[model samples]
Target: MIIRTAMAQINTTVGDLEGNKKIILSSIDSARSAGAGILLFPELTITGYPPEDLLLHTGFLRDNIRVLKEVEAYTTGSDTMVVVGFVDFSLEIYNAAAIIQNGEIKGVYRKMNLPNYSVFDERRYFTPGSRPLIIMSGSLKIGVNICEDIWVPAGPTNDQAIAGANLILNLSASPFTSTKNLTRMSLLQTRAMEYSCCMLYCNHVGGQDELVFDGRSTAIMPDGHRIVARSFEEDFLVIDIDTDQSTRYNLLEGKRKGYCKKAEVEEINVIIPQRKHQEFLPEETYRVSSEEDDLIDSLVLGLRDYTKKNGFKKVVLGLSGGMDSSLVAALAVKALGKENVIGVMMPSRITSDESKKDAVELAKNLGIETFEIPIESVFDSINGLMRPVFSDRTHDVTEENFQARIRGIILMGLSNKFGWLVLATGNKSEMATGYATLYGDMAGGLAILKDLYKTQIYRIAKRINEQTGTEIIPRNVFLKAPTAELREGQKDQDSLPPYEILDGILRLYIEESFSLDEIVSKGFDRETVEYVLRLLQRSEYKRKQGAPGIKVSKRAFGKDWRMPITNKYRD
Candidate 1:
C-alpha cells in the first residue's frame, strides 16, 4: 500500500485564532489539491503554540474550540484526513491532535509528555494523557503524538509501534537554538530506526516574542532515508511512502509484547484508496544552515514578526557608526524594509568625524533615511544644570552616560513623534557586564542583538557584508577600535577586557554554567574571570529592565535565564 503525506510547516501567531484557522484551512486545500491523502500540521494549529497565559482564559479556550469546529467544517466532503493540534477540554485541558475526515471527528490524541523545562511550561497548563491513539488508513496503522512525547525513550512512539503501528506522525512547535537542529534530527532518525516505521514531523515556523521556531520539518522512511523541509520558513512537503516495507518489521514486534498495553490503545479505522503504478518523486533534502546564516534569518524573522504583529509599520534606532549599531541598522533594513527604517545619528562633541561620516555612509548604503542630531549644546546645558548639585565631583563615567541618555531621549522623542518602534543596539557582551547604561542605550521597545556576544557581532557583520556582496556595513567599522565614543579616544577595551578573551569567558560562565575554578583551568586568568563574573552578577538589575530580544543561544538572558536582582550568593 502506498500513502501520500503532506507536512504543512506554517508560521502561526499566538492567540490569533481566526488568522491561524484561515491558514490551516488554506493549507488543507493546498494539500488536498496536491493529491495527499494524509495532511499534518504543527502543534496547536488552531490557537498557535505557547498561547501561554491566554490558555487560562475560558473565553480563549471557547474561541479555540469554535475555530477548530470551523476548520472541521471546512474539511467536510474532502477525502483527505486532516490532523491538527488544538486544545481539547473535558474536565481539564490537554494538548491534543484532532483527526478529521469527511466532516466527522475521528479521534483526538492528547499529548502524553508535557515538557516543563527551559522554555516549556506545558505541565502548568495541560494534563498528561495516558492512552495512545492509533488511526488506520486502509491496512496502514498510523500513530499520532505531540512534540515532547517523541523525545522520551519508552514513550508513545515505542508503544504505538509495538501495537502494530507502521507509521508515526509527530506535531511539534520546537524552538531554535544554535545546535538544536542537529540534536533534533539525530533523535528523529534514531526513533525511526528503532521503531522500524516511517515518521513524519511537522513544525511551526515564525517568531513569538522571544522564541523563534525554525520549521525544518522532516519525513523519515523505515529504511532510514530522511527528507527535510526548509529552515526558518514555511514549506509544504509531499512524499509517497511504501507501507509494505514498514509492516515487514512486524515479525520482530513480538519482542515488545510485555512492554505494550494493547487494551489502552484507542484505534479508529478509515478507508484509504490505494494508488497503483503511482510515480514516486525523489525526496528533497535540506542542507543545514551555517551558524551565521541561521542567526541572521532567525533574527530577521523575529524582528519582522514582532514589528508586524504588534501593529508597528516602522522602526527607529541610533546609528552610532559602531559595529553593534551598524549591524542593527542592516538588520532593521532587512526586517522592516529600507523605506520603513529610520537611522538617527546623535553626535556629541566627543564623537569622531570618522564615526559621523561612517554613520551617514552606512545609512546611505542601506538606503535608509538618516537624521543628524548633534548633542554638544544639550551636553553643555545638562552639565551646567548639574554643576551646582555636583559641587566639585570631577568628570567620570556619569558624564559619559549623560551623552548616551541624551541620545536615548532623542530616539525616544522621534519614536513618540513618528510612532516608530525603537530598536536597541547593545550586544550580549555589553548587557552581560553592565557596560550598557540603563534608560540610555538600553532604552528601546526591542533589543536586536541582546543575546549576541561582541565577537559574534563582528562575525555577523562580516557575514552580512559577504552575503550582500557589498560593503553595506562600512569596512572601517570593522577595522576601527571598538568604542562607545561618549568621550575622547574612548575604546571598549578601556574598561573591559579584549573581546576574544571576554567572549570566551562569558560563553563558559553564562552559557556553559562553568565554575570560576573550572573556567580558570581553561587557561583564562583567574582575576579576569572573577572580575567578569562579578560584573555579570551585579548587572542583573539592568537586564531585568531591558527590552526583550531574540534568543538564538542555549541560554538566553530572557525567559531562559532567570536570576534574582538582589542575590548575595557567590558561585
Candidate 2:
C-alpha cells in the first residue's frame, strides 16, 4: 500500500500563537490540496520551539491548547490526518504531538527524551513520558515521537517497532550547526533501516533568537532510500512511501519480552480515506551546502529575522574598512536592503588614508550610504580632560580605548537619533581573548559575527566577493592587515598572536573544549595556549554583556558555553 505524507517544514516565531496558528491552517490547506493523507509539522509548532520560560506561564499553555483546538477544528470536515506538536498539560506540561482525524483527537505523543544539555533545558519544563503512542490508520501502524525521542538507539522507536509499528513520524525543532544536518541524516537513515520502518522527519526552519533552524526535513524508506526537503527555508514535502516494505523485516517476538510492561503502546485507530493514487515522483536528495555557504545563509537569516521580528527596519554599523566591519556591513545589506543599511566611517587621527578610501569604496560598491565622521576634536577634548586624572602617565592603552569609546558614542548617537539598530562587528577570536572594549567596540544592539572566528571571517569575505562576481568588499580590504585603528600603527597581531595561530588555539579551547595541556600537545606553544586561556577566562564578563549572535558552530558563547565569571579553575 502507498501512503502520501506531507512534511511541513515551517518557520515559527516564539510566542506568536495566533500568527503561528494561521500559518498552520494555511499549510494544512496547502497539504490537503497536494493530496497528502498524513500532514506532519515540526515540534512545538503552536508555541514555537524552546518557548523557554514562557512555558511557565499558565496562560501561555492554555492559549496553546486553545490554538490546537482551532487547528483540530480545521480537520473537522476533511479526511486529512494532522499530526502537530503542542504543549499538552495534564497535571504537568508535556512536549507533545496531537494526532487529529475528522475533528477528533486520536492520540497525544509526549516526547520521552527531554534534552537538558547545551541550549536545551526541556527537562526543566516538561515531564518525561513513559509510554509510546502508535496510531493505526487503515493497515498502517504509525508511531509518533518528538525531537529527542528518536536520538536514542534503544528508545521509543525500538519499543514502537516491537509493538507492530511500521512507520515513525518524528517532529523536530533541531537547531542548525555546521555538521548537524549530516549527523541528523545519518541517524534518521539508521533508525529507519534498523526499525524496518519508513521514517518521516519534519524539522523547524528559520531564526528564533540565537537559534537558527535549517529545515532539511527528510523521508527515509525502510530500505534506506531517502528524500530531503530544502534547507534554511520553509518547504512542503509530499512523498509516497511503500507500506508493504516493512513486512520483509519483522521484529523478533523475544525483543518485546522485557519491554512488555513499561512499553505498552497506546493505540488509536482512525479510518484513512483511500484517495486516488497519484504517480509517486522519484525522491530527490537535497543538495548539500558548503560550510561557508551555510554559515553565510545562517548569518543572513538570523540578522534578517532578528531585526524584522524585533520591529527594526534599518541597521547602522561603524565601518573601519577592516575585515570584521566590512563583512558585517555586507551582511547587513544582504539581510536588510542596501537602502536600509548605513555605514559610518568613524576615523580617528590614526586612521589610514587607505582605510578611509576602502570604507567609501565598499559603501559605494554595496550601494549603501556612508558618513565620514572625524573624531579628532572629540578625542582631543577627552584626552585633555583625562590627562589630569592620569597624572602625566605616558600615552597607553587607556588613550587607545578612549578613541574606541568616542566612536562607540557616535554609533550609539546615530542609533538613538534615527532609530537604527547598532551592529557590533567583533569576531569570535577577539571576543574570546577580550580584545574588544566593553562600552566601546562591543556596544551594540546585536553582534553579527560574534560566533565566527577571525580566520573564518576572512574566508566568508572572500566567498562573498566570489559569489557577487565583483569586488563588493574591496580587494585592498583583504590585503590589509586587520587593525582596530585605535592607536597609531596598530595591528591586531601586535597585541595578539597571528590569527592563524590564535584561532587554532581558540578552536581547540572553546569549540573542542581542550585543556591547556591537550592544546599545547597539539603543536601550539605552551605559553601561548596558557595566555589565550587566561584571556578567555578573564573575558567572561564582556561576553556576558555582549549582544546575542547567530550560532553556526557546535558551541557558541551565547547559551552553549556557560562559564562562571569568577571561576579560578585553570588547566
Candidate 3:
C-alpha cells in the first residue's frame, strides 16, 4: 500500500490543445520517471480552464474531447494512471476527469459541483454531474472530485465514501485573490479529518489574465497532516502513502448523500511495508513583488506566451524616442531574445535629436534591429489635405494626434508586411486619464504594458536596468521629466497630477474600489482626489477600447474589472 501520487500543476492557455497536450505529456513522462503510479492534473487541463465563450462553439468541445482521447492513448502501456481534466460533451457539456490506464479509458468522472459565483461561470456551460468516481489503482480506493466538489460537506464524495473510498483526489483551476490559500488549507484539513480519508488536491499554475492559480497543491493524510505540497508559479508534487495506515485507525461515517440514508462505516485498507515515508518538501512562500516588478514580469510572461503561442519567432515593435514606446521596445527585447526583437524609430516634425539618439542607442545596446522612419513629408501631405477645410483655428491636439496616427498606421503596415504583432505601449495612467490618442498609439494587437501606471513604468524600466547591468534604456529617458511630446514641450504632468500621487489614488480607487470621499479621507487633497476620481469615472469607455494588456495586479482593467460605463452613480 505504498501508494505513489504526483501532481502536475501546470500553466495552460485557454483553447491551446496542442500546446497543453505537449506540456501534459512532458509532465507525465517526468512523473513516470519519478516512479509515480498516479498523476493528477488541473481541472480543464486539455482545453484549458474556463474556456469562456469558446465553450459556445460546438466544434471546440468536439475537438477537446478528441484531444483527451489522444492524450489517453499516450499514457498507454505505462504503469502510470493519469487523472486529468477536460470538457466532455455527449448530450451535454461536463467538467470531467478522464482516468486512463495502459492506453485504455478506465472511467470518466464528471465534476459534481459547478461553481457559478464571481469569476466562475461553469454552471452556464456544464451540466451538473451526479456521481463521484472511486477507481481502483492498485490497493488505493481512489475517490475523485473536481474543485468545489470537496469544498462542500455533502455531495458525490459522500456517495463514494459510502461505496468504500479510502482516498479522495480533487482537481482545480482555483484562482488566487488575497487570502485564498489560507481558506483552501483550512477546508482541506476539515475535509480530510472528517472524511477519514487521505485527500490529494491538484490545481493549475501561473497567470491567466487576472486569475493566477497559486498552485500550492497539497496532499493531506487521514490524520490531517499535509504530507505533500507544491508551491505557486508551476511545479509538480509527489506523495507516498501507506494505505494500511487507514486500518490502524477507526473509520468515521457521514451520511451517504444529502438525505438521512443509514450511515455505514466503510474502510478498505491493503497491507504495505511500513518501512519508510517520503518527507514533504516545502517551497519558499512567495511574497507579492513591488507594483513595478509585478507589472514587468506580467508583460514579459504575456508577450512570451502570446508570441510563442501564435507561432511567431520574432517580435517587431515601433519604438518612439518617448517613454511608452521605449518601455515596450525594451520589454520586447527581454521577452523574445534581443536578436528576435526589431525596433522601428519613427520621427515626425516634433521629434528631438535626443529622442532619435536615445532610440538608436537602446536598440544598439539590446542588439535589436532599429530603423528610422521620418514622417515629416507624410504629415505635410496630410496637413495639405485638411488646410482647405480648416482655415481658422491654429494647430492643437488634433494636429499632434495626426502625427501619432500616421506613426501608428505606418507601424501597423510594417507589422502586417513583416508578420510582427505590434505592441502598443500606452500605460494605464494615460489610458485611465484619456491621454492616449485614439487610432494613434492605440493601434496595436497587444498592449505590452497597458495595465501599468507611468510611475510603475519607470520603476519597471529601472528594475530592468538593475537586472541587466548595462545601458539598455538611455539614461536621459530616466532622468528627464515625462512628456508625450505631442506638441512643443507638452508634458504628462502638465495635464495629469504627479504620477506618485496619481497612481496612489488610482490604486485605491480602481484596484481597491474606494469611493471618492473615502479616498480623499486617506490624507490626500480633496480637489485633486475628486478630479482624479472624476477622470477615472468618466474614462471607462476609453479603457474598454484599449489594447489587450497583461494583467499583473489583483484588479486589471480587463474582465476582472467590469464596471458600467453608463452609470450615473458618482461622488
Instruction: Give the per-residue lDDT of model 1 (tens digit) for 247-286.
Output: 6654455334455455368889876555664465455585
What is the clash tally of candidate 2? 0
Candidate 3, 420-528: lDDT as tens digits: 7778888888877787877888888788677778877787788888878876788988887787777777778898999999999988887787888888889889999
Model 2 clash pairs are: none
Candidate 2 lDDT over 1-571, as tens digits, reads: 6787788999888999999999999999997897778999999999998899999999999999999999998888888889999999979999999999888888888899999998999989999887899888778888999988999877898888887788899999999998788799889888887778889999999998898998999988777888898888789998877776776644432323354334688889887655456466465685678888999998998999899888899999998888899999998998899999999998877988999999989999999988889899999999888778888689988888998888899999999999999999998999999999989999999898999999999999999998899989999999989888887788898989999999999999888888899999999999998888889999999999998988989899999989999998888
Cα error of candidate 1 at position 158, Å: 1.0
Candidate 3 wrongly placed segments (more than 4 Å):
11-13, 16-19, 22-26, 73-77, 103-106, 112-119, 130-143, 148-168, 174-200, 205-237, 241-295, 564-567
User: In lDDT terms, which candidate is top?
Assistant: 1
Candidate 2 Cα misplacement greater than 4 A, ranges: 249-262, 275-278
Candidate 3, residue 28: lDDT: 87
TM-score of 2: 0.97
Locate the minimum summed-lDDT window of 10 residues in model 3: 266-275
**What is the Å distance of residue 423 in model 1 from its true position?**
0.6
Q: How many clashes show up in model 1?
A: 0
Residue pair clashes in candidate 1: none
lDDT of each: 0.90, 0.88, 0.76
Q: What's the TM-score of each model vs. the native? A: 0.97, 0.97, 0.82
Model with the higher lDDT, candidate 1 or 2: 1
